[model samples]
Target: MAHSRGKRRLRTLVRNGWISDQHGAWPMVILPAFVGAQLAHRGSIAATADTLAVIDPVLATSLPITWLTGFLCFTAIERWALTPKKRRPSCLPAIITWGTIATTTGLITVIRSPMLLLWTPVFLPLFVAALWEVLHRRPRSPLARLTTVTAASLMLPVFALGVVGAPSPLRTTPELWRATAILGSYFVGTVPFVRSMIRARSDHRWEHASVLWHLTSAVLILLATIWGAVSWPIGVLWVIIACRAWAFPRWQRAHGPVKPIIIGMLEIVLSIVLSALIILA
Candidate 1:
């Protein structure tokens, strides 16, 4: 019997050492479990944050249970999903995609559903991963093909919703200029970096241009005004970094050095910025 392309590719990857029969396959079970838990944990995460914000904006110290579920969620993904041996094998990004929803649900518990109201962590990381595929890798799995289609449909909308659904704090002017600029900065600035080589296709120029442009674009996004009220610059940028989800695979497929390094640097900067802005804000 002829195997389907997916089975054939998995066979190839397994044979060539691109993947393995490993515990990463646990996501088939773990993902479904997390989705169920998120339904119950959602209210718990929200109520805890809403109630606690009064004592201290920081809420650094709280009852153990208050922080318990969110911490469990975080630790579960960071520990199990990022397991080194399991990282390269199986489909970890999809697992992380689910975790992003889990992260948002848990966070909504604390911030009253408006904190990052418009933002959905699931979009950028996964979309960028797909974009990286468009730019670099070949589609191997049916799910991968489906995800790429889903991503293409959602890319502009993700940024568009992020622009439009920007809350009252982010939209004081009654006009969308601020939000537009903010989204523009994130979109135009980064998209070019992603496509710079493809568009220009130069040798040394791609290297220097990617670094310079990536830094400049990232800083602008971090500092970009969201109607001047929504000032969590670092956190906003940090999500961008976390969503730099495609950088590695793109590098593997394209045999390019610049984009991946630029992507890695942005991921680091955004991660730090997100943590600092959200925590300290």
Candidate 2:
């Protein structure tokens, strides 16, 4: 039964301009409507409420469009660059790179200085690419990706608790401990889990990508938590960077990683600038 369904789905995709082996090989305006809705919900309604003391019809009207565009962007990236296990490139390099990013982000947040703020934007691409590994078409165990996301999500809330429980703003004791605990936990928990997930990946292209992508996101998550729990809100840039994963090339290029690396650095710089301005203001 499963074999037949797989065959059917493959046929449908191939007929519709999808490549035989790409992850999201067909161009689609993917509508991850739910997640998209969540992203715009709070901001739009809040903006509207502050004006008319109620929900603005204009804001509500734009919500679905915002979600559709974002989803389609991701879909386009997937269809172009990714494929299944049979045609995968080297997953090790990508996975290792993302892992390093995660570890570094975790380290920065824990032993945080202003430099950590510079790294906030790179978090997004790292994260989204890794997730594409899992979410894209491949035989990798989605369970592994699910595990990483679930555990990490739980840690974010835990860190928030520590922050919320901190001394009142009137007090002199700065809330550095929140950073220490959350970043530490984020680092420690992520390493073992990512290692385990990578081991479990079936050497498929998408699986390998997912492993790398998740590791990157895990690091970004650490940065985001630190900003949320202990420092300035420069982590918002991290979210933007992660979203850039939807623009990844169809395969990991063996040539210079010039473009991606440069983009990543640019994001970090943007975060630094934003942070500096906020602090100065």
Candidate 3:
């Protein structure tokens, strides 16, 4: 009976596009989450550990639940948008998604982390805009994609602040917003680079523009790091991104398109490296 129930759950996840097809979404959430948590702990995992020492591990562990909640929330909205308009209500996915959201919110309330609550004001409008985009079934516009990716990037710091028990934007340090920009730059820059590489490959104008965009991004990140807006390690990431903008597309030209799985793996590695550096910074 338990085995059959597990199979049913697995089938539901697969039917809802929540399984392997969604692998690309994880790093987008994970990296920023790491950056936020690290920033909240001031780049020290030990600091977070020391602070969480007094708190319940259940709450500490609920960090991942927040990530799941965010993903489910977005996925639900997407699914809701995709559902055909029928007079007969057939909204099982939406029901499950809302159930998950409610359960996650209960856990968060129990945890008593206010950082996430503070961020909700900023997160809600962006989320609604995403829903609107999907509802209209418009092709993913660059600006909309950028906005969504940038919003996902912010989740990390918010979750990180919660992990370290930082209260409701009480401190408002330079590091707070700096972390967001530093992380936001990399993910948002990918929009142009990706366009130049895969989507707009034959368009010379866009390709050149993409290269220029990445180069400018690298230079700006370098200037910001030199100005001490963010740590030097993050600047290293920009250098790599700049090189990717210039080189990765060429490699793809010769190799005939890198597999999505391979790209996802590389991104995971990049995320790990970034997280490690921030933790040690």
Tens-place lDDT digits, model 1, residues 135-222:
3433333334345334332322222222222232332332223333333333333333444434444544543444555566555555
TM for every model, in the order presented, reads 0.27, 0.25, 0.75
TM-score result, candidate 1: 0.27
Segments of candidate 2 deviating more than 4 angstroms: 1-7, 14-52, 83-195, 198-281
Ten-residue segment with the worst summed lDDT in candidate 1?
A: 55-64
Each prediction's Cα RMSD? 14.0, 19.0, 4.9
lDDT of 3 by residue, 109-155 (tens): 54576445777678778777776776676426665676678778877
Worst 10-residue lDDT window, candidate 2: 23-32
* Backbone clashes (count) for model 2: 17
The CA lDDT of each predicted structure is 0.37, 0.35, 0.64
In Å, residue 83's CA in model 3 sits off its true spot by 5.2
Best-to-worst lDDT order: 3, 1, 2
Model 1 stretches astray by more than 4 angstroms: 1-191, 197-200, 203-227, 232-259
